[model samples]
Target: MARNRILPIFVPHWGCPHQCVFCDQRTISGCHRPVTATDVTRLLTEALPLAGQGAEVAFYGGSFTAIPAEQQQELLDAVGPFLRTKAVGSVRVSTRPDTITPETLERLWRGGVRTVELGCQSMDDAVLKASGRGHGREVVAPAVALLRQYGFSVVLQMMTGLPAQTDESALKTAWALAALQPDGVRLYPTVVVRGTVLAERYADGSYRPQTLEEATALGAEILECFLRRAIPVLRIGLQPSEELAKSVVAGPYHPALGELVKSRVYRNRAQALLETVTPGSDTVLAVAPNRVSLMTGQKRCNINWLRQRYGLHSLRIVQEPMEDWEIRLQSSESLDKINR
Candidate 1:
């Protein structure tokens, strides 16, 4: 299947009632203004020609279905022509789990929405309450089932490093979400934004956000859980934006957060292979050329790690054509044995 090219229209927290502790939607979305139907029409008009066929028009950064009904209809009405003409293949909206209902799904279906992404941030009720989500964990599964029942493709979004979240809790949330068997998932590691409750908490030492290392480590663990179940992880971190960069007060925010997590995956995989071999000074790892950096890690951290752990005088990563996630260990004896 072709990867989706999304034409995003940011609503920027227009309909959200709860002020989640970590949210500064304007900063996160980089949109401080409200969106109108006219704006939607203009965006689609400009984007459709460039979107190519089967591009999705996504209403992101807000509770789309929770907005005023008239406004929702007006926005949907704006995209009606594109859908009718097949200029756009489908429509998608992101909304809270509690906001989904039979009536809303029917309305969305009539408006040509084929995908509904729920911001089911955590499966722990305590985490939900601590974050000011205003919804219980109980609402998530039924919402997923209901959306599936209504023929909409489901994407579940979960977060790591929330106020009460631990590595164990985050993993549990992933397992729970996987059991729902959604078509896709998004993993957003929490970042503290300025002018939010999180910022105040960070300043007062009430909430401690995960460091980049911590986030990447936990993210890799969560990511592996999803991959093992064959669920596609559509996104690994928040989309980096200038506004978000300026608004961040503290926490694990990295432009290349996804790459870091994948790099950790490579490190772990290589470690497993190393465990099966005897320690040697001249050890080398042969990985796919494209993933050399991921295999070696940022600043050659993985290379340094393997060398120290194995007591090697030299540990080198070389380019070799290999299958996905493949890494081969090479040494005098090991290489010869494998070649034989």
Candidate 2:
């Protein structure tokens, strides 16, 4: 397992010119107020001793580069001592794609910001406009290129089920992001939070959040595409927080959103195996014990889905000395019974 550590510091909606339709950063980030340099210093002083060596300090919940230069430097300076001592490896920040520029990249590079995550919600211009994202898809590619040119690791964040977004469009967006070759990706399925335009739209029946099942399936597909390209998926869903949970008015905002996506992937894998097995053949599926929960979904949803979809009634899953994500299947009948 990777040994890198991360300390997240929230800057709720900093440098935000206007509220996006689905934004409620205060609620989502669980930090309603701006953080000062002193706050950053105190947080690091308290967290550093507890963190592993080579930990990275992350600034999230706002457009870091777009924030005032003085304030940005103040926040960066607070962590400068630690970085110089090698107590912290580097700094990371999330910002809107449009907020990035050559100058911003240079400033961040000079301040030890080694990673930049762009909130490229969707790559479809229409979806971007409908979701009230000020920038279009065209803005993200160049931003990513610029960040990479500055020798900074680039992470792309995408959302599903946004206003005017369809599964096809979302897939297209994922493909575009893949083409950008970002070092990491984050998938955040849209959820309606209180005090956002989305909440009102939901109340008025103009917008509906993606159902849990739909989001899980779509997220699985998105994850698979990135995995195929060898891109690290930094996050699969929003980190659930008390503030965010209570504020959520609708949508698939499961606390274990990552687990849900894993379950869907397992289900897809199981189905693929079943398709190759002849009808009435008995099959025993083997997976790591720890993955049983994810393979079965929250409540055997995957198992039930398999039964209904493939007439796979005589299936058995056993724990094996295998990796978490891999599965093996053995058939009771002749090997020829394998349809494939």
Q: Among these predicted structures, which one has the highest lDDT?
A: 1
| TM-score of every model versus the real structure | 0.94, 0.93
lDDT of 1 by residue, 1-340 (tens): 2357899999988889898998888889988899999999999898888879778889999999899889999999999988888888888999999999899999999998999999999999999999999999999999999999999999999999999888898999999999999899999999999999999999999999999999999999988898888898998999998888988888889999999998998888888878866666577889998999999898999989888887777777877788756888887557657669
Candidate 2: tens digits of C-alpha lDDT, residues 162-206: 999999999999999998998889999999999999999999999
Cα lDDT, model 1, residue 191? 94
> What is candidate 2's CA lDDT for residue 226?
89
For candidate 1, the 10 contiguous residues with the lowest summed lDDT are: 330-339
Angstrom error at residue 3, model 2: 6.0
